[model samples]
Target chain A: MAKATSSAPPAGSHAAAPINQSLTPDDKIGLYRLMSRIRRFEQVSLQHYQGGKMAGFLHLYIGQESVAVGTISLLGENDHVITAYRDHAHALAVGMGMDECMAELFGKATGCSKGKGGSMHYFEPSKNYWGGHGIVAGQTPLGLGLAYGLKFKKLKGAALCYLGDGAVNQGAFHESLNLAALWSLPVIYIIENNGYSMGTSQSRSSAYPSCLAERAAGYDMDWELFSGEDIYEVRARTQVAIERAHTLSRPAVLEIATYRWEGHSVADANKEKYRTKEEVERFKNEHDPIQRWKRVLIEEGIASEEDLKKIDKEAQKEAEASGDFAKASPYPTPESIFEDVYWEVDNKTDAGQTGRHFFND
Target chain B: MPRRLSYRHALREAFDEELARDPMVVLMGEEVAQYNGAYKVTEGLWDKWGDDRIVDTPISEAGFIGMGIGASMLGVRPVMELMFWSFYTVAWDQIVNNAAMVRYMSGGKINCPIVIRGPANGGTGVGATHSHTPENILANFPGMKCVCPSNAYDAKGLMKAAIRDNDPVMFMESTKLYGEEWDVPSNDELPDGELFIPLGVADVKREGSDITLIAHGRAVITCLKAAEILEAEHGISAEVVDIRTIRPLDEETILESVAKTHRAIYVEENKPFCGVGAQIAYMIQSTIFDELDAPVLRINSLDAPAIYSPPLEAIQLPTPEVVVEKALSIC
Candidate 1:
């Protein structure tokens, strides 16, 4: 087992530090528990969808669990988070209850968005989770705007904006990067490079497949890349990027290299048509983050096989309970359709009014 | 108490007062600060407020306009100038997609409190690209509030209203009417402390029973002039209504005038097909179909683009003579 080091040596040092490190006992246990929860939650969600218990297109964060849990664990409750449509794991990682998230997937009244937003448009303002914007790269400007608002309010909070690598091709992405850099806004843009935008590979889609961080230089921003499979790497890199964003009130980008075990959506079967089965097996066997963490846990004396079994059992039970709660929750009433589309205060008009107050009527 | 001032001076005064009121408010455009604005509307702002408040950006319309959105998002109230309405094409993305939809698309999480001010319509010999009015294009956007002030009082009141409002406002200033002077009432006559002339409310510039002459922006002057000519020569008394805000659309005021006058003549500086005049005509036809004595007459610019040649440009846009002729024919 590799020992975890407190201080990371320079990249080109004569005595280079080893890449793989066993986490502390507590951290190993925590990592296994979080990954188990995410994996079980997503698997249960998939089963619910297959059973016709869930509605809408569910984009499961199965293979990419570490990226969400690892990075989000470093953020405080006061910090803001915004992401694209592939967002269930993000909502879960940010402390939204499993029942509420499951209810949202089931299109029930008890959902986080009151079942109005469905899968692609979840929002929990109380948690500082901005939204699950479906438009490719649409949330870039909005995330930048949120960072701008933080600066305007003189708050010492930073905003984390997550998007797929596919979203980087959009004009809003470029425009937002330029604007965010120009204004020195406190924002960290995390591009989750899962290698596929729907079905097209990143090589076929992007002109430059080297690293999204390379594009950050055009905006003159500090950038880094991390292996998404390694939770510690993601956590460490994100912490540094987010700390810099908050301290300097400037934007940074962190491109995470991850893979999706499931197909893009529930509709697509994992047939291995795009890539070979051997390739999928190679990643699943060699770089399966969940298994890698378990191995580290065993080496670090974090947990026994019995301890892992107990954690997985608890996760499965919790997921089942959440599914049951979601199933029992009622669908939104007809009148609920009109509500929450726009916020309504007791006596004040919404911002769009020409002159008349909203509640005056 | 009331004092007389030119439309240009009133606009400048509004900018000055708003800047004094809010430390975050800044003005940016080409020649706005150093060259005293494109039309002398910002003559003394540079000297008074210095470079920070009164900014002069490069001719990169897209860049500065985008910067305005960025700055506005950062809690600054930016009043951007586009020299002419025709030049708005260069910055349409920053305006339409970014500024207008940012609030709505963000699920009302943010408000873009920025004002884009510029001269629209042709009367000056600038010709073609510089002369064409593009208010209809801007009015088509859902989240934007479009305001075109014809007189000095409305100019000051509306500019103040826009600067203070929480939404993005497209404030269209007529290049031809900047020199036209009018009586601007003092604080006593103003509505409360807000001083905002409500958007989509038509001002009855002149009252007559013969016909209702509807116009907006620069065309309001043409309509008023035509109304005078009709009263003097043809004995046709025309009630001229200056439609200030185009989006919310004062259909109530217009319908009331059409019901009283029994005939209507809608004039606009844009193209004839599907212009603001067509919208007014549709509203009148739908609501007050029986009240109309004759079909709602629409006098608009030619369907083709405003040509560079003086004669062709003249033919394209509706002049006072054309408004007079159209009104007489309709009567």
Candidate 2:
């Protein structure tokens, strides 16, 4: 049941309506800062990994920062957020400080998961951002369950679940979508269409690859596909989806057509062997979200070139400070291993202790 | 002062009592509503609670399971029925990823107080796909508790405990034991409002000093029958221990029995390779390596797919004869 909003345009208007009212200069500046924060964080993380400071498989959210920041900005703090392993940006966007996130990646004791979970499993319940799950499509049902919990508890909030194009292949994704649609769970399933799923393009992976929004019809769901490169478009489309999710108490799918600027993980080289350099250059020149937004900011007088430079420098400094803090953080002791596995009353007592004989000697 | 009740009746009573106690409780699954549940465990629930609470889902395992997860997350205490335990593979993601990992992943902010109940273990020749005991597969996951009750008493206690538990629980009900009757405490004697059988506690069915025989679910009955034969014919006093919960195993009970008996034998309906029996064996070997007079023995189903034929299935799964032989060998 699509509600007839008075502001909605007549049918077949491909051009998205402006966000009802123009964003103020401060709003624009905030969006820019958020995106830059994600960008700089990923860049610094990559540098740290390359310098042998951060271990494990690092999936950078470099070129796709706009999608996470733009979509997450529309959500409130109480709302739940779940995403796949490419999760540093989602964590930061959901109010997780940079220091703790970087510290987790560095495997420090002060990390969000107390260094138990590395890059792929950064959990921070304080912000309601569920940890980054390593298994693909594993978070879908959990997201639906979270939404179910919210509705069951009568909480005034929704759950936003983000997955990659590759995850759609998993059975859990389809199963969760069917259930969410049937139950009308307050969940928004965002498919970050970053062209490929760990090197396999969507065309080769999905039987129908034109747009994921079309797949929603099978589940009797309403969907929207938007230019993920455009922050304004991402924001407007996600806001509509989120609003629908809240009002209808149902799940909606939003396909964000974005691209990853680097390899899937830290291992692969961005040689464009499978794809042509021309294709990469085309996206870089035409669809670079940061550059496009930077141009918009300068032309719209939201900020000057000097102001943008200062913002970039501040973001870099913040990222560098986070790296320093993570580097200075202590490694988790052997005692920390037994803790947090189960929330037991005697966990502290068992800490720094040796095994005890249960029977008489 | 216990009364005799069938496993199915005991489960139904548990559901009735729990629903009457907590308004947050509901049930959903295939054939659970109009059909009164595939195994009739929810016989009179639909008429009592109506459709809103007793939901009948389509033949979509993944869908309804996921929906149940969602509802549980929303603070609904949902008891999802999988019809048959083997079909759990269809919704493995929901069970493993969401239900099992939610509390740990959320850093204890969220707890999935949901119970996924289904008929597990082989009996009545349900054939290969319908008769495989997949508790071992579920036991591999962390944060999820697995309970397999062997009789009416345990069925009621374990079901009530699972519903009240804060973590997600995989409650495996044996199809063969549904009609079996046993002595169970009446509802009035139960804990006020709701009752709980604490997780990770073992029940010693029969006490002896010669050897400790450990089993769970359908195998508990098998081990009991074997214990009867071991005592009467072979003149061996074997202690039978029922492992009600698999994950947080009752290590204290097991180790205590092993220390006294000086020998142990595990009986399971699944394959031997990395089965629940293997875990028990490893724990015993690690904790009580010096206490054993002889090597710990295990009687498990052969590592092969269950066949549709009766003889083949019998050969694949553990039988009373097989358990008795293993216990005697351990002695």
DockQ for every model comes to 0.19, 0.35
Task: Report i-RMS for every model.
Answer: 5.3, 5.1
Question: What is candidate 2's CAPRI-style docking category based on DockQ?
Answer: acceptable
Off by over 4 Å in 2: A1-22, A344-361, B66-75, B101-111, B190-195, B285-293, B329-331
Find the 10 residues in a row with the least total lDDT in model 2 chain A. Answer: A351-360
TM-score of each: 0.81, 0.90
Give the TM-score comparing model 2 with the true structure, all chains together: 0.90
lDDT of each residue in A1-361, candidate 2, tens digit only: 2321224344323124465146678888888888888889889998999999877799988888889888887787457888999999899888888898888889888788777778988766667787598889877877887787777677767899999999988887887778788888888899998888888888888886357666877888877777788677777767777777777786788888888878789876754676777887788788888887898789877799999889999999999999999999999898655444333212333211212211122
Q: Write the per-residue lDDT of candidate 1 for residues A1-361, one digit (tens) a residue.
A: 0211124434423112122243455755776787888788889989999999866688877888888887787777557888888888888777778888788889888877667566776666667777687767767766775776577667887888899989889876777788777778888889999888877888888886357766887778877776888666677667777777778897888789998888888887654688777877777878888887777677657688898999999999999999999999999898654343222211134333433211111
Please name the candidate that would achieve the greatest TM-score relative to the true structure: 2
* Candidate 2 lDDT over residue span B1-331, tens digit each: 5778899999998888888889889888899999998889999999998976788887778767876776676579999998998899888877887777655554454557789998987756877788878888887876677888888888888888778776678999888889889987775765763445666678999999999999988888988888899999999988999988886667778899999999999888878888888888888989889999999889887877777788877777788788878777667
